[model samples]
Target: MEKIFDNTEAALALKSDSELERARFLFELIKRDTLVKIGAAVTKFALKFRLPVEGLIRSTVFDHFCGGITEDDCLPVIDRMFSKNVHAVLDYSVEGKEEEGQFDKAMFKILKTLEYARHNKAIPYIVFKPTGFGRFEIYEKLTAGKKLTQEEQVEWNRIKNRYDRVCGKAFEYDVPILIDGEESWMQDAADELAESMMFKYNKETAIVFNTLQLYRHDRLDYLKELHQQATEGRFKIGMKLVRGAYMEKERERAIRLGYQDPICKDKATTDALFNEVLIYMIKNLENMALFVGTHNEESTYLVLQIMQRCKIAENDKRIWFGQLFGMSDHISYNLANFGYNVAKYLPYGPVRDVMPFLFRRAEENTSVAGQTSRELYLIKNEMKRRKLVKSV
Candidate 1:
């Protein structure tokens, strides 16, 4: 098998032969299409039948992906990440509806995460979605830059209050809250709202972070403009760079509307923009705190090189590396091992509510470049080192 990292010394620094053997066994299981199919089917059936799978899910993917069902429940896993020098971005993964009650629940949850984060040194950040507090359609409409009704405007005000409470709580606790990126149709509103919150809450420090999706053709430049705007306002900017989500939907919508697609022309273009964004952020490190959330080796390496050239500290508060909890342990653990600030976006919720997210992860791995293959290969390498494979 072709090695993704020929520098095996660097790659294997943290894992022993025994660990590698176990990884190989898991890799073989991950590589099988059958495992995902059976897993998804069982999960789907459990949801349909309303059978309890919390115990099973907790032992399987939940253990792999989530922090825990609650704050106190997550400490053991949080401590594990800390042992590896990985920070925790505790996520309350319960999706909220548009109703006022649900919005209140989400706000309370964010506040709770902040309160809990206050006492957890390993957890410096948490994430929340605007949709957790508002209707998607309302944000989609607002993104069209259309005028909103009094009622809609009032609702927007209430949404702002929700975020203000969350951010304030985080700030009082000296933790940060990341506002997640959402679908393109509603992304504009999300961006605008986050910026408004940043300008308000980011006065003394960057307490709120806005995720920027680089796949959009205009966003790289938009990031630059945002830098200028932040400079002008004299407020620190925080950005989390992601290649994108919603690619297929964006393409389909563009085709259906007889319009140019907003996405980059190709994956290479997206990658180029991602690296450029990192470069810009590194160059202006004082004015911005940047988080690179990627599994791409090239992008991750590029950030390291840039930081080295600029003599930035590995533990610089303005920079972070993040990976989803269940994936990319190599990058996360190794970088953390190297004394850089790294984090795992550890999500938590009940099984049914989180299934939507879980299924999407499985689907994405199956389609994404080198993801599942890479995962499987690493697992296999570990297993081989362990001599765990049975004779044919």
Candidate 2:
């Protein structure tokens, strides 16, 4: 079978020899279990005690995984990716903030991102987490059908107003906004709010996107329900489909809280569910705009196969592929090379504030079987092909 994601040269073309060498070293460290454990531990301790390790992190993983510490810092990366025909999605990745002031700040930054994106054709969309605008506990309470106190109610209203301002700006600029998925406990509120935004702004087309995590056993059904709602409500649907990021956290919480685990039974099941949703969305492309956000080779192939079967154009505006900025250049660059609409989820924030995001990337590479190994293999191949390596 011909694979769409096998173009190692195209994948690594944007990376300089030194960048590839650094990536190789990073992935090499990630592939070693003991080293990853020790590095993670040391990183945690250093951050806790205010030790000076930001420079080391900024040079290595942060540079690789994140755009930079601010929106302005992301411009060179955006231009570089756009030069390769890959678009960018600016994601403000600061997490675990709770104060109303912090929420307002996040909203301000996102609005600025949208304003910037309005002028930059290289950026297709902007994204933020719901928790970025409000407290997680409040979202959990709302999701659980619990009543909020008077002060909490006021806080909830403020969160909604923040969302409205951002989405309103997105609507004004004619740029779509993606609301990232969160843990299942808080997802219900996020989903409801996302739908409300869609209903308000998506009457003409999908301006507000809701991410669907297919690793959850119920998400396929949720997709079906949402499709029905869209049909009846007379609005276009925008969706970014992924295999889920918070699988371990969801399962651990379910176990500790004595609730059923929300994740699919295994990787195979998740893959099946993801492909099923992809097919469904493609079949209904008239009312749906889809973003395939996965690094899995088979899933990428499945999307190509389905698009071909459906006679959808390679550069259809309603369909796009997304991968994280640094992890899956093979997929992003290869797809974009073929004239497909592709974007990199470029995350940016202060280094210290974005450590949670960086640590998750490190842990994901270390824990996911073959993830780091595959990256290492591709980088080494590209290096050898360029004769950047004197000896193997």
Candidate 3:
């Protein structure tokens, strides 16, 4: 780990001066937590009231954080990233839909993405939220060991069918699909379902990747147990390791419900757990594949160090480094420049439907200590370097 992420030239190679300035402006705005909250409220209200705010939103935060409104809209970005050896995972960013029709539509969108991935070398993977394919209540009910009514049972079967269909299509296309992690209450059902998919489609390799929110104290044990099961069943395991996004919601729910908090005690505990799991996965790379999704330079470096120590190739097909689009370009691009596999999570959807995802990105940048500041620092450094060169 020789300070690879500091190379801003490689990181910002794809951004023009105007695009760089836009990124700087976005991060500067995201640095103010109060402003982010107020903006989120106003944006929600505007969208709900059908105000003429889409243009403002699209020209600012939306363009910075999202790919476009549809899969075809994402082709240029995907091709540009691939030119630099970085891949793309086109995530449809719609959220909070629960109707069967909506679920069916989401499944169709994913199937289309899989077909695109089959033909496009730039788009190596596709992702979807479990709730996007089914109702949250169904997952919660199932996770709680509650029985479903006749109607609910039919809904559950439809959800399972959605999973099987998309997974089977992904397997047929030979493109890995990442199933995202959600709240702890609903995740048990999703985890069990992901395991079954892996067992069914991952006999030769890991085609179905489940997400692990490592912020939870128990997920390491869960991963270990899953690993043991995969070994016993003789199927490869695929996992995307993340620190989780729903910490506050999880805490509030546990407190309200009088249950144990699922999150770790503090940031340090979470970081330690993440590192421990990283090491464990690297050590057992033969039986599994990993997608390391983090913006933390130290954690990214930790993975690089472990890979080097283990004598793993820089461009290991079974391991990938991923960061969200419009964030952490330094990490994503620099890793790719160094011959490592990297992918940016390119979220695409209608401006209104994608607001929740954008708001989360804003909140995350504001909540995570020093994240926005680090991004600003890198952006300014690159801008200053370019200016000095011009003056010279």
Candidate 4:
């Protein structure tokens, strides 16, 4: 309420002049939809053919957007952010693996992060994708209410087991774990699985945080229903509320498959849905905890105002403000500077394995109205405030 986010020095305190320049250049490129699309295509082609582009990619976007290529690789970043009081959520960013071996590998990777979190206060949480632990087709089939073959059922059971293994360890370590939301078709089954984990592990506190992609119109109702069930079942609900990342995919698929589009009608509808759900969860803070993940300034301020109105301490453990590692520094760092609980989603993996995640980040920046430009503006303002850039 005191206009804290405008403090460029505090917002970019951790960034040196070189890092600020790099962020400016990257956001400038991301502002161009055509350029981002062409870059994504060319990057995919380069990675596909094993061209010698990993170093270039690593020096640029990878360093900006991700912590590192491995858990050990991320240590400096984790330590530096925690120096500013911003916590990290170690995310293994590898995507789109269908093999059982790959699933097991992802599970092991998360288990390693949980171990890291057990010893490090810098990492307050760890996260995983539901599909990362199992096959997407299995989740889709289960969500559709279709019968699974014996082998498919076995795969599904294995997926559930993977969830339990990581979640059980999280409970043991006393670290909160976040499960990311995926596209609508596959999310129902993942939601059910996350609910079961919460019911099992959240009896004392919220250890398992399921994602709510509020861009979907039905997610508010889903939250209400889940809340009712959570209350009656005597378990706490931990949720990561996001504006969603798969809007284009969701809409195109709905049109192709002749089903109602699961997305809100437009940006306004999605924004309203996100805020409405935020308020709903805030009101029920006794039984529910929140990880408010957004790049929108208005919504971030809204959360601050609500916390003040509810007399919730800025450092409340049950509530946190989260943003991506490479984006929204003003929101993440400034909030942390104000004694608020804040975490950045620190995505990391091998360069090739993480390309898909990077592509989506670029596409999301381009598609979201004003997001890229706002980032550019803030970075430029910060640079000028630091005397690294000339005033217009």
The root-mean-square deviation over C-alpha atoms between each candidate and the true structure, in angstroms, is: 3.7, 1.7, 0.8, 1.6
TM-scores, all models, native as reference: 0.89, 0.97, 0.99, 0.98
**In candidate 3, what are the lDDT values of residues 1-392, reduced to their tens digit?**
48988899999999999999999998988999999999999999999999999999888888888889999888988998899999999999999887899999999999999999999989888999999989999999999999999999999899999999999999999999999999999999999999999999999999999999999999989999999999999999999999999998999999999999999999989999999999999899999999999999899999999989889999988999999999999999999999999999999999999999889889978889999999999999999999999999
Evaluated at residue 48, the lDDT of candidate 4 is 95
State the lDDT of candidate 1 residue by residue for 208-273, as single tens digits. 999988898888778888888898898889999898877878899989988889999998899998
Rank ordering of all candidates by TM-score, starting from the highest? 3, 4, 2, 1
Write model 4 residue lDDT over 1-392, tens digit each, in one string. Answer: 68788777888889988999999999999989999999999999999999999999999999999999999999999999999999999999999888999999999999999999999999999999999999898999999999999989998999999999999999999999999999899999999999999999999899999999999999989999999999889999999999999999999999999999999999999999999999999999999999998999999989999999999999999999999998999889889998999999999999999999999999999998898887888899987777854443
TM-score winner between 2 and 4, please give it: 4
lDDT of 2 at 302: 88
Query: How much lDDT does each candidate structure score?
Result: 0.79, 0.90, 0.94, 0.94
> Mind giving the per-residue lDDT tens digits that candidate 2 earns over 1-392?
47866678889888988999999998898888788778878888999899999999999889998999988999999999999999999998888887889999999999999989999999999998999999999889999999999999999999899989999999999999999998999999989999999989999988999999999999989989999999999999999999888888988999999989999999889889999999899999999998888888888988898888888999998998999988888889999999999999999998888888877777776767777788888888898888954564
Model 4 clash number: 0
User: In candidate 4, which residue ranges exceed 4 Å CA deviation?
Assistant: 388-392
Clashing pairs in 2: none
Point out where model 1 deviates above 4 Å. Answer: 1-42, 52-54, 388-392
Q: Which ten residues in a row have the lowest lDDT in candidate 3?
A: 1-10
What TM-score does candidate 2 reach? Answer: 0.97
**lDDT: worst 10-residue window of model 4:** 383-392
